[model samples]
Target: MKTTSIRELKHDTTAVMAMVANGESVEIRRRNVPVAVISPIPAKSPIERPNFRGRLKEIYGDALLTVTGTDLISEDRGDR
Candidate 1:
């Protein structure tokens, strides 16, 4: 890790970026205290699921639930 004043960062941004690419952290100072740190962004791991789709299909059946419109009306009770 290294520290640099804001003025130094503004003067030579290319050098600062080079340091980050080299896997070294650079701390930017405002007056005499550290204000921000710069480092290379970490890469994300690739996801691997061999049977993801099959597992989902097995969990939830491939069917849609439906009800006939007439089922909402009450059945006639006069015959009782």
Candidate 2:
């Protein structure tokens, strides 16, 4: 972190912004007292989340079939 007075910040705004752009934090001061700070926003991940169901079907060759809960229970009960 670097400290700069308000007067200096106003005069050297471009330089202060450059420091922030390069990932450095700049503390602004008023008459030698801390007042504000400037920093860069963190980078976000570029990866997109994949559709897992689609991926599963793709890898397993679309073996999925629809079956209801009642159907499952009847199948389990059998001739009992």
Candidate 3:
């Protein structure tokens, strides 16, 4: 990690970007205090494919078809 003032970052943006691309972390300071950090992009982990139909069948089975919702609220007839 390298500390760089905000002024230097503003003056040479390309150099800072290059450093970041080369796996170097950059610390930007403001008013003589550390403010921000620029680092390399993180890699994402691969996602596993889900068996939707099989999972649903295993979890719900025949109950999925028999389940029903009953409306309990009555409509209020108001005058226009």
- Candidate 2 lDDT by residue in tens digits, 1-80: 98888888889899999999999999998978889998899999899978998888888785755887899999999999
Worst 10 residues of 1 by lDDT: 71-80
lDDT of 2 at 33: 82
Once fitted onto the true fold, the runs of candidate 1 whose alpha carbons sit more than 4 angstroms away are: 49-80
Steric overlap count per candidate: 0, 0, 0
Residue-by-residue lDDT tens digits, candidate 3, 6-79:
99999999999999989899999998799999999986788989999899889988664533333222223333
Q: How close is candidate 2 to the true structure, as a TM-score?
A: 0.62
Instruction: Measure candidate 2: CA RMSD.
Output: 7.3
The candidate maximizing lDDT is 2
Ranking by TM-score: 2, 1, 3
When 1 and 3 are scored with TM-score, the better candidate is 1
Candidate 1 residue-wise lDDT, 1-80, digit = tens? 89888999999999999999998899999999989999888877998759977987888679554754554443433334
Provide the TM-score for each candidate, comma-separated: 0.57, 0.62, 0.53
Q: Which stretches of candidate 3 lie over 4 Å from their true place?
A: 45-80
| Local distance difference test scores for all models | 0.84, 0.89, 0.84
Measured with C-alpha atoms, the lDDT of residue 65 in candidate 1 is 49
